[model samples]
Structure formats: C-alpha cells, structure tokens
Target: MSILESLELALKNIVSSKTRTVLTMLGIIIGVAAVIVIVGLGNGLEQYVTDSFSDMGTNTLTVTVMSRGSTRTLSVDEMYEIVDENSQYLDLCSPTVTMPGYVKIGSETITSTSVQGVSEDYFSISGDTVASGRGLQYSDMAARGKVCVIGAYLNLAYYGGNAVGQTLRVGGQSLTIVGVLAQTDEDLEEGGSDDCIYLPYTTASRLIGDVSSYIITMQSEDYIDESVAVLESALYEVFASDDYYTVTSMSEMLETMTSMINILVGVLAGIAAISLVVGGIGIMNIMLVSVTERTREIGIRKSLGAKERYIMQQFVIEAACTSALGGIIGILLGDGLSIAASTVVTRLMEETLTVAPTLSAVALAFGISVGIGILFGYLPAKKAAGLNPIDALHYD
Candidate 1:
C-alpha cells in the first residue's frame, strides 16, 4: 500500500478508538508542554538579568579597597591619575560613598531613599541623564558643595517634578537639589530604581567617612579583560597585595548568570523529556493490543495476497500519526501556558517578563515526539507482520 493509504487507514483506526488514542498520546502532550514552558521561563529570566546588568553598566567595573591593616592607602586623586595614565583602556572613574540615614523632605521622613556620594563623571559612567537643571560638576566636588541630584521618584513625590533648587536633609545636612534624573524605570514608586540621591564624593566624605569603593568604566567592552588587568595591576601596587583590594566586572557577572540559566533550563527540559519516553511506551502497548484485536482482518488481508511490509507500514503510520497529532496539541497547549505564565509572573513579581517559546524548541519537540513513536512502534509492527495467517484466521 502507498504511504497516503497507510496514513488514511491509521487515521480511521485512531478515530474509531478516540479514547484509547488520547490516553496513549497523553505522555507526549505533557512532556512537550512542560519542556516548552520551562525553556520559555529560562529565556525570560536571562533577558531580565541582562537588562538589570545593562542598567548597572556592563562595561563598568566595581573596585573595593580593604587596606587590610596596611598603612598604604589609595586616594581618589591617585585612582583618577591611574585612569588618566591608562586612558586607552579606562574611560571614567567615580568614588562611591554610600550614606546611611533617612532623608527628610519638608515634613516627610523617607527611609527608603538611597543616598550616595559620586563624582560628576559618575552620571556619565552610569548612563544616567539629567532631565532638569545641571548635574554635579568638578567645581562642586572641589569645594565640597552641598548640591545634589535627585531621581525621578523623589522629584515627583516631594517636589512635584520641580525638584531643582529644592532642599532635602540627609543626616541633618541640607543639600540643594541641582538636577533631576530622567526616569529609568517605567513606574516611579518609593524605594525603587527611581528613588535615589547623588551628591559630590567630597561633600559626602566630609559628612560620612572616606571613600573605599570606586566605579570605573572601560573605554570599550571588547577590551574588558585588558581593562580589568590594567586596573587590577594598579590597585595591587597601591595595596601591595591582592588581598587588600578586589575588582569585579559587571560583564563577566552577566555572562556567568546567562550560563547558569542555560544550564538550569537544559536540566529541567531533560527531566521533562522523560515523559515523552513514557508516552512512546504507552503507544507501543496500545499498538500491540490493536494488532491482537485486528488479527482476523490481518489474516484475511494476508490470505488475499497482502504483503508483510504493507501490514507493518500501516501500523507504523498509525503510531506516527497519533504522535504527530499529540505533538500539535502539545504545541498549542504549551503556547497557551506560556502566555498565562507571563501574565501571572508579571502580576505576582511586579515585573514585565515575557515567556516566549522559541520556534526551534517547538519544532524539536514535535520531531522528537514523532521519532519516539516510530522507534517504539517498530516492535509492535514487526510482531503484527510476523503473525501466521492460518493461525490468526482460526484463532478468533
């Protein structure tokens, strides 16, 4: 018989026993859906991580100095000098001083605001743009000016979006807001990315303590390794030991996070694929039962000069058709679940992460399902083909 005739026969058989066919395909359906959803979640997570790292400037490096009881210390000026000397690799440098205290804006005392002391170049390095007024300048840092820049949340919440020239108190020190940053996040809520304060490192040092952490940007991310090496060598010379100082690259961290996500997705997908095997076995079992039930038909066809190959072909086609149908249903179900998952995650986590299954994943899932059907169907098909016509004819 032709392949099309075999397929038609397979469909008729599947339709005639709808409940049994569905039961046999259940494993394939569940396995395909599970793998697709897991992979989609992984993709969304990786994108989220990449975006977060990008906001922090993936080309930048964060350095922390411990000094470790050593008398030698690196000053902000020395650090700038090192960057200036290695101008080819390093671009901008900023001393970061994290201040601890509640911010008092008028009568309101906000405890969630992040107040930091940074240089004029800090805004450039961090990719933060000033939306109103002017940013911190070299003159402000030189004279330890009390001027500061505010994020969008603080600007709109307290100053009604006119934060420039307004004053807020941090640790009892009044700082005039010189600029308002452009909104970085979609929603401006309290304690979010848009709620922040930035002042000159010199003024912050005077109020708090000396700066021990610095953020430096590379001229190009392509030369990250070289930039890190140069910066590390300079820091090593200052501390006289690697233990006294540490440098961390944001790009490297991003890569590590992506790799971890891929590995996790792979493992979860592999585990979910086990169901496909179970489903294949189910199909094989059902096909064997089918062959037994149709023994009289097989015997009559064989007695009428039907070939063994034709008998085997019909059974194999039936199994493949069943699996292919299940795979199509699984693809539809997986897509629906992915969309639902995206919405649920967004509402629960308060973040917009899209769960999108790739075309390759769907195609691969379908291919594997069909392949499994053929593989498992072969033994049953062989047994049916090898049945003795005389015995089958008289048995039932």
Candidate 2:
C-alpha cells in the first residue's frame, strides 16, 4: 500500500482505541512538560541575577584590604593616587567605611538602618540622586563634616518626606541630613534597599576605625580584565604582597553565577528526560499487543499478497503519530504551567521573575518524542511482519 493509505489506516487504529493510546503516550507527555518547566525556571533565575548585578554596576570593582600584621597599610590618599595615576583605566574611587550604630530620630531608635561613609563621587558611581537638598560635597570630606544623606525609606517613614536639614544621631554623634536620596525600590520598607544612610568617609573613619574597603569604577566596561589587572598590580605594590588585598570585579562574579545556573539546569533537564524512555517502552508494549490482536487482519492481508514492508510501515507510522500527538499536548501543558509558576512566584516572593520557556526547547522535545516512538516501534513492527500467514489465519 501507499504511504498515505498506511497513514490513514494508522490513524483509524489509534482513534478506535482512544483510552489505550492515551495511556501509552502519558509518559512522553509528563517527561516533556517537566523538562520545559525546569529549564524555564532556570532562565528566570539567571535573568534575576543578571539584573541585580546590573543595578549594582557591572563596571565597578570592589577592593578589600586585610591587615596581615603589616604596618605598611594602604591609606585612602594612596588609593586615590593609584586611581589618579591610572586615569585611563579607572574613572572613580570611593573609600567605603561601614559605621556600626543605631540611628536615633527623636524618641525612636532604629537599628535596621545601615550607616556608611562614602565620597561625593560615590553617588555618581552608585547611580543615586539627591531628591531634595544636596548630596555630600568635597568640603564635607575635607573638613570631616557630620552631614549625611538619607534613603527614601527614612525620609518618608520618619521625616514625612522632608528629611533634608533634619538631625539624626549616628553612633552617639549628631549628624545633620544634607540630602534625601530618590527612591530606588517600588515599596520602601524598613531594612530594604531604600533604608540606608551615607556620609563622608573621613567622618566615618574617625568614628569606626580605618577604611578597609573601597569601590572603584572603570573608565570602560569593555576592558574589565585590563583594568582589574592594573588595579591589582597597584594594590600589590602598596602592600608589597598580594596576601593583604583582594580585588573582585562585578562582571566576573556575574559570569560565574550564570555558568553555575546553566550547569544546574542541564542536570535537572537530564533527570526529567528519563520519563521519555519510560513512555517509549509503554508505546512498544502497546504496539506488541496491537500486533497480536490484529493477527487475523495481518494474515488476510498477507494471504492477499501484501508485502512485509507495508505491514512494518503501517505500524511504525501509527507509533510516530501517537508520539507526535503526545508531544503537542505536552508543549501546551508546559506553557500553561510556566505562566502559573511565574504568577505564584511573583506573589509569594514579591519579585517579578518570569518563567519563560524557549522555542528551541519545545522543538527539541517534540523531535525526541517522535524519535523514541520510531526506535521502540521497530521491534514490534518486525515481529508483526515476520508472522506466518497460515498460523495467523488458523489462530482464534
């Protein structure tokens, strides 16, 4: 028979036994859906990490100094001099001094607020803007002024949005709020990104020991490796050893996070693919039973001069069609689940993470399902083709 005629026959058989066909394809459906969902979740997580890194400035590098009993410590002026010398590679430098203390506003004492010492250039490097009043000035650092900038959370929650020129005590020292930063987060809550404070590094160092950390921005992100090498080399010369200081680039950290996510997704997808094999086995077993049930039909066709190749072609096509149908259903189910997962995650975690499945993943899954069907269907088709016409004809 022609291929089209055989395909028509295959469809009729599949339709006549609806329940059995669905049961056989269940494995393929579940496997494809599981793989797609897992891959989509991985994609969302990677995107979230990349976005978080981008907000923190990927062209920036963080340098931490650890005192290894060496009296030769790198001073803030020396650090600035290094950046000034390498003006082509480095653009901005700011010494970060974290002050440990609770913020006191009137009778309310808030310990959740983070107080840090930075420079006038720190706002530009961190992409923070002054919503009211003015940001830290160079004079503030020069004279060790006690002026500070407050985040939106403090401005709205404590000062009722007019925080500039307000007085707040940090580490028992009274500091005037010179500026209120523009809100970065959608919802301003306590201990969030919007709840923080910034002052001059000079003032903070006097209160909280010496400055041990610095944030430096590069002139160009395209030359991150060259810039990092120059910075590390300069720090090495200052301490005379690499053991006293460490330089880390945000771009390098982002790449490492993405690579780790990819590896995790690959392992999970591999595990979910095992179900496809189980589904294939189910198809094979069902096809073998089908061949036995249609023995009379096979015998009559063989007796009428039907070829063995034609019998094999019909059975193979039937299996492939069944698998293809299952794959289509699986793709639809996976897409629905992905959307639901995105919504549920967003509501529960309070973050917008979309679970989006890629087109390539869907296509590959469909192809694999069809391939499995053909592979498993071969043995049953072969057995049906090899049946003796005389014996099949006499058998009940």
Tens digit of lDDT per residue, candidate 1, span 171-196? 89999999999998989998998999
What 10-residue stretch in candidate 2 is worst by lDDT?
66-75
Q: What would the TM-score be for candidate 2 when compared with the true structure?
A: 0.97
Per-residue CA lDDT of model 2 for 215-291, tens digit only, reads: 99999999899898998898887778998898999999999999999999999999999999999999999999999
Residue 298 accuracy (lDDT) in model 2 = 92
- Candidate 2, position 164, lDDT: 89
Regions more than 4 Å wrong, model 1: none
Error of 1 at 52 (Å): 2.4
Task: Output candidate 1 Cα RMSD.
Answer: 1.6
RMSD of each: 1.6, 1.3
Best by TM-score: 2
